[model samples]
Target: MNAIMVMELKKHVQDRGLLFWMLILPIIFTVLFIAMFTANTDDATRQQVILSIVPGYVVMFVFFIMISMVSAFIKDRDKGMTTRVASTPISPYFYLLGKWIPFMCIVIIQVIVLFLFGRLVYDVPLGQPIILLILSIFLTFTVTGVGLALAVIVRTENMGIAITQIVALGGAMLSGLWVPLEMMPDFMQAISRFLPQYWAHQAFQDAMAGNIVFTELMQTLLILFGIGIAGFVIAILRYPFFLKRAVH
Candidate 1:
């Protein structure tokens, strides 16, 4: 089961389209964001803007990473590969892990790439590299569960793509991706409170500020954890096995 899962993971990574979605798109967005924000800023303004963006970027980062991972699962289920996986010693959880491990690695790579680019090109201060690393890992794992649930529940690749985009875009914006929670409208802020992206962004914001307060960070982490758990439960309980049945 482990061997099959590993092979399957490798096969997914080797695919050009999957690789682009997992790694390249995030990198592209990171560069574009940094460029646009820093273009007209003074030294101080550049630093300020970059610092502000850290949290939102983290949210968008995890969101985009999920798109490829979920799509991989959709493609497998579409092609009967998921059924073959089920017949093997591998269980649904193992299959989930197989899809997760690679994308987590991609997220880590994206973090390093973006962090360095921000520092060198945008003059963004690199604050506590260790903490940033830990934050990135935590965010990646949390999103993996969400992606797994999305893949399991979505009936078609097209629908999966649509759902992920909607979730990603809406969640990010509501969670203060385009604007911080403090600055957003009251209704948007209220809505953001219910979404996992809000808590995830909160975590990044707290971490970037160097607050390092365990209790505060835990609130955000716990909220994201709760979301992941709920999604996983739904996916496990409601996961469809038959293509025809799943469609209707």
Candidate 2:
């Protein structure tokens, strides 16, 4: 399992296109948002805006990992790698865990980098470091689980990538990543409750302000993992059908 996880991480590291989308572009986007959030000269509002939005970028970019995962599954199926993997003695659970855990770690690292970048470049602070860390862990699991399920759901690489964009962008918009929930219509804000992004963003906001409450944090964790559990169940339910098709 460790070997498989390392190989998957190495594969990601070697893919320049994946690197561009997953790493480079996110950092650039964060930098751009830093400028926009800094436009207001008022110190308090500036910090609040930075705290509110920087975490959104972290969650948004982590969402793009779904595309890479879906692409990997499709490409492997096309190239006969999935067939070979299926024939191996390893259990499907181990194989999926090997893939999923690495991406979770990757997203954690990415989120940390983004937060540190915010701190260094913009003097932004996350008042409770542990709270942010906990949120990152839950958020990573939620996103990685979705990525795994998506890998088997799409029939084609193009479809996978297209869906990734729609979900990532649409979820962010609806969940108040691009705009504050208070600024949106009542109906739109109500809709945000269904998205894991909204909870993750709220958790991060609480962490940033050192306002962490155990009940709220636990609630956020539960909602995030609930989404993850649903995704994993869906992936398992469909894996046999997808594997049969891939091997043939």
Candidate 3:
């Protein structure tokens, strides 16, 4: 497992495509979107918009990890790497730990980079540092879980591409990342609640606002944990079948 994780982490560092999605794309979008929205607004309004959208954008783009996750799994299978791993005596749990942990580490770095960018570039008032850190960690767990689940569930590169579009694009739109939830219709708002992105975004927004009520924090934390746990459970249940298919 340690070997598998080290291998994945090294690959992640060298993958220019992964860097583009994880860092470059998010940075470009953040600057463009923040500039576009802050235009013509008063100082207070601009600050408010910056606070809202910058973190929302962070939440939005971190999900692009899903594409990389699916691709990694499929690439390994197609290249016979999965077969090699399966032939070893490693437990499936250790194998998955190797995969999931590296991504979580990647996400933590991604979140910090984006947060620092927002702080220096946009003057985003990160009200509570501890809350932000907690939110980042929990959100990464949720996202990594979803990514791992998709990796096992999607069978081919083509399908992974299609589903990545649906998940990365669709999740952002439905989760109120594209626009504030209050501006949407009541029904759309209701639907947004069901998305993990929505909950994570809400937690981020709350943390930014310093709205750190105990019950509210607990509720948001619970939802994030629940989503992550559910995703991991699905992945674990399906992993055996995935291995069999890959080996065959």
The number of residue pairs in model 1 that clash at the backbone is 0
lDDT of 3 by residue, 1-248 (tens): 89999999999989999889899999999999888998998999888788878888888888888888888888888888888998899988899889989999989899999999999998787787898899899899988898888899988977877877787678888888888888989988998988878887887878877886778777878888888888899989989989998889
Cα displacement (angstroms), candidate 1, residue 133, comes to 2.7
Winning candidate number (TM-score): 3
What TM-score does candidate 1 reach?
A: 0.84
TM-score of 2: 0.95
Q: Which ten residues in a row have the lowest lDDT in candidate 2?
A: 32-41
Residue-level lDDT tens digits of model 2 in 132-232: 89889889889989889999889998999899898899999999998888999999999999999999998888888889799999999999999988888
* TM accuracy, model 3: 0.97
Residue 218 in model 2: shift from native, Å? 0.3
Candidate 1 deviant stretches above 4 angstroms: 240-248
Identify the runs in model 2 with alpha carbons over 4 angstroms from their true place. Answer: none
* Cα lDDT tens digits for candidate 1, 64-118: 7666766777777667777766767767665666666776676677666766666
